[model samples]
Target: MSIMASRPVPRDDASWRRRRLGLFSVCLAALLLPICFSGGAVATPAIGAALHGSALEMRWITSAFMLAFGGCLMAAGACADAFGRKRIFLLGVGCLLLTSLALAFSRSALAVDWLRALQGVSAAATLAGGGASLAQDFDGHARARAYGLLGTTFGVGLAFGPLLAGLLIVRFGWQGVFAATAVVAALALVIGTRGMRESRDPAATGLDWPGTLSFTGALASFTYGVIQAPALGATAPEVIGALAFAVVLAVAFVAIERRVAHPMLDLTLFRYVRFIGVQLLPVATSCCYIVLLVLLPLRFIGVHGDSEVTAGLRMTALSLPMLVVPFVATQLARRIPSGVLCSTGLVLAAAGLAWLARTVGAPDTGVLCPALWPMLLIGAGSAMPWGLMDGLSVSVVPTDRAGMAMGIFNTTRVASEGVMLALVGAVLIALIGAQLPDMPGAVAPDVAREAVNRLVAGDMHGAMARAPAWGEAALRSAYEHAFATLLDRLAIVTLLCAIVVFACLSGKTRSGATDTADLGEPSTDTATP
Candidate 1:
């Protein structure tokens, strides 16, 4: 390494000030991006009407952005490391700002979807290297503080996005939300370009287009099948074809990663069980997370007859823990026992689901009681692993392979989330089939059709398309049943994740001796850090 590669200059007022501004830039971008990732789930009823799309397509609106956003992260991260972190991050913010502006003008579903894809591209470029940037700028103790702050910012983003979206959609309509995001992104971009310093570990990066393409294709193919499987039958020719393509592409991704000079991911990260397992939960946990996150809002707006503002506010209550717990957890992360944290939190998450299930049959406000405690637990539990898992995921790899390892880590979480959401949607579809007023096989033509048609035509904007007065009665019943069933599934996943984490830490107790030496490369994901 040349002296230039590790340059040291005066660290003064201007340098310090810009670093602070850069942090602000990254955090704002992080918050803005998730709204797109969430796909207006909170405002689905109204937005669905405005966009002239069905309830199902609303799910896809968010899911599609996740694919592009989370799917192509490795390539973006590598680009950051290769070209320069500050440069790529700024470029991503620019793209996000432009796409948000474009989205505000979008009329058709396709246009919104495409702009979101662009948003994902920009988000990945800006965010993948963000944590590393913080770690770079601050001293050791301050690095941890910065991490806690970053987590708080993300929690706030995740917490308030739906709430904000819901209110914006109700007061000014959905376009207002996009307009706000555009403004936020623009502000972040300008600050980042002027304030952020460049960061690169020159040795960690090189062009790896083939690796990027193969991995992305695998994720894209699989996610497509998952998203389509519930609406289109799993056995449908197109669904089957996508599934097949996914398998083949995934296998080829592994093979190419093995032979490439600058492989996008190092295949060896899996040897460490902790990183491997924690990443898996993001997928599994996310399945339940997405369902509840999407479903609660739907129930509030569509079934309970809450206004979008009211619905969004209730959901915000759910996200409050997501905002607060992570910062505190990040601070205690080094000192606390991860096993206890994850185990207890998982229990809390499961309990929250169970409580939610029990209260599902009640009106919207009733569910709040059971829902509140669990939200806190789930948020705290999930936050415990973020710093530890991420730290472990990359530190074990060589500096040169860090980008690929981070990429792999992120992809696991994102891809798993895609699969889990698909799974839940399939289950929900099956449940809905049974609940329909007519024969189960005939979905659109069922007895529910004429009434549904009125809603679809925008006649029942206030009354959930004039669904029966008993509709809440019926819908709440379905929610109770489905949510209970889903809670059981989550319990199983939580237990499994806990068991896996426990098994990985079967003997080792003490933490903090990071395994950095003699470690090899990581396997997959466009999430290269």
Candidate 2:
């Protein structure tokens, strides 16, 4: 069992060097993935225009990546644990390098869509392996510091992605963004391959393919159904069929996991109330805040007539605070109870959203000055629980099961984001329809949906041209009214969720297979398991 016998590497200087190298490699992956995601958001319009992609195809460009990434995350986590985390991490970096290069040259929308999906799959592996590696390599206070940096990296990538992409797109077009990403991935691959030592669960055997397949099917079908529902009615055959299939697959996945000897996920993690609460923080944040990365750019470009670069710069208000707050949270953890900090942060975020909602409906609301204060509040508030949640997710599980635990935690974060996007889109489209009940002509619902879609995609001119019967002034008024209404409802729901998160973490922090002593003191539990 000696380190020398198993891997046969020098232990004196090489050990610390390996750890440092591994940490950087993982943080680099964290940094790059968000850029891939949010950069694509900034580049989507140009990509669609150049490829002559239809509205549906454009939607798929983002949806497909999210669907694949979320669906494959847990499976990738399990694979990393069974195989070597280093091997899996290297594989992911290699896949990303190749796919990003391919994406840069892709001329067709369909090709771009598929390439993005490949990138998503690789990203899933990279995140899972990288997180698991960090969890295994560092423990106690060191683990806290490492995760804090990881969270900061996540914020930097997410916050600056659009600004960087705006510059890239302006200078060299959308392809330049992907080309630059490829260079980063290539460097990670080389460092990770040479520096990362192999680590895995020695007791692990073969993968539980049934659980993986069922879970993948469930996520894919559900995502497709929800995304399509915004365009096709919820009752449409494709939507209904996909939803039904997703439900069946979900049930099957649960059943299979329960019976499997080595399940991809440990369902028992849900038994810990505090663990469940920690996981939900990501879901709540993604629904209430992270999704704004996509929505705000569209609002600025589509409704406000701002250029892409201008929109990206304006968003610095929201993202800049996110970049700094996680490091601050690391310091605050020594004094404040994590539970209290998380709840307070969520409530603050809700208040900010509420303020933004009220202001968005104003007659003369402009983009920057009016939005800056609220966006800052939202970002600062959400950053409180950001990295602490990651630390808690791993700390609450058995050491041997860190990979599965991280998989479940991150899967919850990402899948919820995708689901929220679809649900919000559906709500927005339905609200638009309700706001404009009758138009001048007897336009089909499909036709009306298409027009609204164009408006949402930042094509006010196209939307007006398509709906000539409806006066431009009236159409703009209706769309803005419906958008404001959507924000109002979202604010209410986010506030309620904040209360739920507070309640979940208010009681005693139950002990699990692993100790959470580092997280701080807690009250006695009042609620029964």
lDDT of 2: 0.77
For every model shown, the clashing-pair count is: 11, 1
Off by over 4 Å in 2: 1-11, 136-143, 361-367, 395-403, 440-442, 508-529
Q: Which candidate has the top score in lDDT?
A: 2
Please write out the lDDT profile of model 2 over residues 315-387, one tens digit for every residue: 7777887777877776676677667778778788877777777667454444455777888888888777774
Itemize residue pairs with steric clashes in candidate 2: 302-458
1-529: candidate 1 lDDT, tens digit per residue: 6987677766786687888888888888777766765535665566556777654455566666677777777777777777788888878888888888898888876677667667777777777766556766888777766776776777677778777887788677878888888889889888888878888876765658888888888888887786666656668899999989999998998999889777877775666555565565465457445556666666566655667776666676666667656556545656665555555555566666655555555433543544566555555555555435566555544455565566787777766665566566566555544554453443343334333322321223432343454354454455456556766777677666766755553333344434332222243332232
State the displacement of the C-alpha of residue 54, model 1, in Å, after optimal TM-score superposition: 3.6
The lDDT for every candidate, in the order shown, is 0.64, 0.77
Model 1, position 61, has a per-residue lDDT of 60
